[model samples]
Target: MKIQVLSSLALVLALLSQGCVSSKKYKDLEASYTQLQEKSRELNQKYQSGQQDLSGSSSRVKSLEEQIASEKANVAALQAALDKCLNSSSQGNVNISKLVDEINTSNKYIQHLVNTKNKSDSLNVVLTNNLTRSLSREEMRDVDVQVLKGVVYISLSDNMLYKSGSYEISDVAGQTLAKIAKIIKDYQGYDVLIEGNTDNVPISQTNIRNNWDLSALRASSVVQALQNTYSVDPKRLTAGGRGEYNPVAGNDSEAGKMKNRRTQIIITPKLDQFMDLIGKAPEKATKAE
Candidate 1:
């Protein structure tokens, strides 16, 4: 009976040992499961953070693309402006060159006219014939005339037009002026300048003060005769006076003084083309004298 009780105690001890081992194993499994759950939470947090970072990166990339397109458009606009500037500059140069050529051609024509006057002896007979036929009978008179630099200058001496220091136009001079007006009217494009020259002798008349006044009045009187009597265009006419300043001969001799007292009517070709050329050239500032 004592042997049987010992065996039963041994069996109970074995069973108790197995139960303790099973409890220890279950605690170990629970700890392992908690660790796995913690690892899963960390992974999920990392994935969400990564998604946020990727979204921010995508927005930055789109903004950079827009900026690049804007810059390209700006570059294209600048290039177009540059091209337009170049074309305008080139056209301007071409226009300037063409204008210069026109001026050169006009200058040559003017020079030809000047050279024709230098051979006046051969041309005088023809010119006088033309003038006599073109003018009225009363305008025919023996007057001293000169041709220089394409200009026909008739010296209406004091004896022909007025008494000494007088501003009155003589009866004969009036007839001659009428004829000249008719000829000038026929030539529409000619630019006319009436210049009066006076002797060196000073005058103190009531109507006139000095040589300047006398010269100016004479020029004005002639211009008025052309304008009022002949109906010449005012725009095509200019009047100037040289008071003993532009003398033809020395003032010492009586004959020289007589030659110096004169009036000149200058006629020239239109200079519109020449003036256009001058305007197109670069501006040169002139200092005050």
Candidate 2:
């Protein structure tokens, strides 16, 4: 665009020197310049948007790591203090009031963790209900939406997501994922894991080494769709394969094998809020605040 603009200006200067510029040619140059500017703006905007997403993801992961470190430090400090309290008591030099206060503080910290866990659990319930309401009866038949251990799991049959021995997502699965993406965007702080599961059947596909390769590829395919097509955060998304293991049912029966061959999308909200409280528990400044 700059080259084109410079070339246009040079042409105009040359024409002006020769006193032979035409109104039509000048107007054409102006229109071309306008279009170039618009294109440049659009490209710049896209570049900035991509940078923002990258920055946001990196910062979030970094913050989570810091919180984990802080939480560990807090836990260690609490343990040391508790041990000191016990030692003092054993020596018959106990301060009953201080001990009681410390025990009460420990109980409060434990309750805080429990409350945060309950909040995640409640979120799973809401997510499950929302998924139940979103999927149609036919769609539900192809997938099972459940909440377990504060995570939302959406299990889809391999047949729905791919052809026999293939890792590509089918059109039906793509549509279902699109719907899921809408729900994902509406929520926040979720770490999603796409796990591909396979049955005990041996694979003869030359491209795929074994069930492991096929399953991992399938999980990766879904992750790509969610990240590229649906704009899910790359940092929050994980892809994995559980090949011929962790089956929901027995592999001896065809029905059971069919159930085993599936993709499960698990969404768990980040425990950052809880971690923050725990991380500051041993801090004097935090206590004062």
Candidate 3:
């Protein structure tokens, strides 16, 4: 009976040992499952962050492309404007060069004309001196002649030319006028300008109202006399009156007033070169053949 009790106790101890082993295995499996769940949560979070980063990068790339396109358009517009400016500047420079050349040519022509005028003026002075030397002493005393500023100036006092405030020429003045007309006719291609001057005096006659009328009438009379007697071309002659103006001396004394009452006959060469320089020559008129 004692032997049977011992065997029963040994069987109970073996069963308790098997229960402890089973409990230990179950605890280990629960710990491993918890660690695996934490690892899965961390991996999910990393994947979401990567997706956000990729979305931000795409947006930045789109913005950069838009900026680049805008810059490219601006650059093209600027380039076209620059090209236009360059072309206009080049054309302007060419026009300036052409204008400079024309101006230079015109200046050269003007200089040549001025030199010729000087030479002509010198010759006229010599001719006037010769004429004065050849004149009789009485004639020289009656009439005064001088060359000034490339023009011949003659002074005929009231006693020589006309009575007080009279427009009629005296016999002596007529002879002098004839001599001057002969000289003018001999000088071809010369323009004649007759200017009448009067002193500051009032005149109220039946035929003359004021100094201007008297002066104008006197100039006109001289012009008519030259045209009728010498056959001077009307186109080559000009007459003007400067009454009480352009006085040579002050009108304060009798001598000064006498000096102021005078007529001037000016002769000048045709201004061909000067007119050409200033582009005043008439353009060729188109005539039908």
Candidate 4:
């Protein structure tokens, strides 16, 4: 518009120089030129202002775009964290379930062990009672019946079980052995151990070399009598001897020597039963993953 205005002013000036118009027309044309110039100045001012406003608007748009990108990144990071938390919660629930199962299994195994111990104790108590009830008052004077740690021990004096200073079985001992054999036969699952203990006195018998030999022979003799004479199972019997080592009393006096010379019949459940119970136990629990 400025260029068009300047071209029109130049045309008017050239016409005036040639006197193509009167003074009044030239004056009118000059007035139009002045108004056009003023309008051009106003348009230039508005254009400058618009350029400044456009530059500021572009900067604001760039800043807003950057802010939007940053917000998107923050949202992505939060989503990742949420997903990780959800996965961890699921794993934790599974671990808790496994731990509960392990605890339940352990409790069941412990209860089974407790029940087995109770049954063993009951059996031992019944065996002890039967032996005590079967013995006469005179026989009880030389016999001792006891239950220790789920095993039955019936101790008989050496004088009552064997001939004096010898490993031979006495005639009077047959009745007591028969009664004991009957009780042992009743418990088919139990094993009997005949253990002989002698006083510190040395033996001078023909075949016996020392107290160890005497004590061992005494235990063997009793074991043979139970097996052969009374029909007791030899497989259920084990004979052992303590020369003077397992004495119940000191052998310093005759009374202490008499107390120390004795035979013990120990009755217990078969070892295989206990081993089977142990073998059937559950495996150890693993830590939950």
Candidate 5:
């Protein structure tokens, strides 16, 4: 019995020791499992961080690439504009040269016109001087010579040219007419206009009707005398009449009436020459085509 009791006690002690060792081993396994779960959580956090950094890098790379593409397109556009300018540079130079030539031509034409005007003015002055020098004081009293607007106007009083109320020229007028014809003949480039002016008195003479008819007949007679008797060129003469319409003074007094009755010989540069000069520029331009 004593031996059996001792064996039972030993068995109980051994079983208790085995249970303590198993409990210690289970605690160690639980600690190791907790450490492994902590390590796993840390690894997951690192992976998520790496994914976010990669996404940000991709976005930055795409932005840089898009910027580079835009810059390339801008450079291409600038190159195209430069090429276009180079292609058109020759045409621009030609247009500029043509404009310069046109401006030069216009300047030359304007200078030509100015020279012609100056020549005409000088001729008028010379003609006026010659007429004034040729006339005597007595002749000047009957004749008035004036230069107005590049024209020479020689006014002869009716008393010196014709009898009272007559269109026929007086015999004394022949000498003056001959001198005037000589002057007219000297200026072959000028044209002469014989204009008759009369007072407002009505005419009752046979073969004459009114002031108009008398004025016209008087102008015609002077023109014919200048052509036939004085040997002035008929082609250079023009006849006209002004029946008291153009007056130098008031017609209320006898002196004014006498002043109103006169004949005017107007000498001017031939219009044909001026017209031909004016037309020449356009004709030259047309021929340039």
Candidate 6:
């Protein structure tokens, strides 16, 4: 009976040992499973954070693309505005240049008129001074020379020039006319007018009908002496008869009638060049083309 009891005790010891080993293994497996669960949660959290960052980055990229597109459109518009502004500025500059040219052309034409007038006035001064100094001879003492209102008036007594009721000039009168012709020839550009005057008288001679005829014939005689003898230009001379009219004082006095018998020479400058430049500019330009 003692042997049978020991065998049963050994069997019970083996069963207890197996039960303790099984409990230890179960605890170790549970700890390992808990660690694996913690690791899986950490991994899932990292993936979720990565996904959120990617989504935010994509939205930012789309916004940047839209901004770039809007900036390109604005740049195009600014470029067009710049080109148009430059074109208009160029045209405005052309118009300003053209206006300046027109003003300069007008100024040139106006200056031409002023130059021509000054030249003419200077010539008149030269002519007036020339005649005053030349006719200061002793033989020409009775001859009167005066420039009245730019016209030269020369007066001589009829007693010194011709006989009464006769249209014939004396030798002294011919010499005086020769001196006048020399003076007129020295300077050019003069219109000479010779006038004759007679006192209140009636005449009926050969080719002498009245006082008018005598006056005309006497004027003609003086003109012939100037042109034929002294080489004065006939084209520049004009003869007229006063016939007791146009007396300086009165026909009742012989001295007044003698004073009225005078000759005039008027000189005038030709303004054709000045007038053509001022009045016919368009025609001149057309001809130039």
Per-residue CA lDDT of model 3 for 1-289, tens digit only, reads 3344445445445656677546565555445555656666667656754564454345534544554465455545555554565567555666655544444444444444345445765556555655554455566555666554445665656567666668877667777777777777777666888888899988779888888888878888788888987688777788888888889999999988888898777776656733543453212111100
lDDT of each: 0.61, 0.74, 0.64, 0.78, 0.73, 0.59
Model 3 Cα displacement at 67 (Å)? 67
Off by over 4 Å in 6: 1-122, 137-140, 203-206, 263-289
**Candidate that beats the other on TM-score, 3 or 4, i.e. the better one:** 4
Flag regions of model 1 displaced more than 4 Å: 1-129, 132-142, 273-289
For each predicted model, how many residue pairs clash, with residues at least 3 apart or on different chains? 0, 0, 0, 0, 0, 0
Q: Could you tell me the TM-score of candidate 5? A: 0.61
Q: Per-residue alpha-carbon lDDT of model 5 for 1-289, expressed as tens digits? A: 3344455455546656777547665565556556666676667656754564454345534544554465455545555554565578555665555544554554454455445555776676677667666776578689877665556788999999997778899998987888788889999999999999988767788888788888888899899999999889899999999877888988889999999999999998898985776576522533433
lDDT tens digits, residues 1-289, model 6?
A: 3344455455546656677546665555556555656676667656754564454345534544554455455545555554565568555666655544544443443444344444544454455445544554444466655443234456666666776557887776766666677877865666677787776656768878888887788788878878888888888777888787766667667676556654433344324543454465522433322
lDDT of 3 at 79: 56
| Tens-digit lDDT track of model 2 for 83-144 | 77676746344554565565556555544555555566566666666766677656868987
Model 4 local distance difference test score? 0.78
Q: Specify the highest-lDDT model's number.
A: 4
Residue 233 lDDT in model 4? 91
Better of 4 and 6 by TM-score: 4
Q: Would you list the clashing residue pairs of candidate 2? A: none
List the candidate 3 regions with Cα displacement exceeding 4 Å. Answer: 1-114, 271-274, 277-289
